[model samples]
Target: MAHSEIHLELLLGKQVLDSTGKPVGRLEEVRAEREGDEWIVRRYLIGVPALLERLSTWTIGLAILHSLGARNLHGGYEVPWEQMDLADPQKPRLRCTLEELKTLEQSNSQ
Candidate 1:
């Protein structure tokens, strides 16, 4: 809709929800290709949730923070562009949500 320019700011802090519409991850950082003076996004560093599934939210939160090498806490996930679902123009974060992501995880284990 808005074009490439609108997509610039969207690279940072983009919330990446699972297919079930549950918060699973977010965009930790974006790696861009640099040519001469211009730096264009090449890929992204996803923030994966380090918290154990059954662990207390607070406990997992701290672990997630530690894994991130950050002083604070923020549990999420990291993935490549191909893994994310970008269907809706409005919800530019992710379409994978929790439930769908769970299915994906389960299948990957087998």
Candidate 2:
């Protein structure tokens, strides 16, 4: 990590912008892996579904929302950490367009 690079903890809840400066969503969660002694962030999950996951007891609510197509209201995407530019920290931007990012998979928790 660069001296100016911010940690993933600081990145949570930060808004993410596409390469075109379009607002996508906030950084709801981060996926990381431990390599040797360092924890390297792999992806930044942005959307309401990601946010909902943080609330562990929302299973029934989430299922209802999904069944009613409310999940589409808060569609989530996962951007590879390497493709993100966090120089501003407050407004991390993706190197690619929003469509290029991977769509987050929904769980089978119905």
Question: Could you tell me every candidate's TM-score relative to the true structure?
Answer: 0.41, 0.78
Task: Assess candidate 1 and give its TM-score to the true structure.
Answer: 0.41
lDDT of 2: 0.77
Which candidate tops lDDT? Answer: 2
Q: How many backbone clashes does candidate 2 have?
A: 0
lDDT of 1 by residue, 5-97 (tens): 336455455666655666665555554677787675554444543223323364566666678897643334444454555555345555444
lDDT string, candidate 2, 12-81, tens digits: 8888999999998988888789889777878878887777765653466678887988644645787887
lDDT, model 2, position 55: 60
Error of 1 at 57 (Å): 24
Candidate 1: segments with Cα more than 4 A from true spot: 1-6, 33-42, 48-76, 93-110
Candidate 1 Cα lDDT to native: 0.49
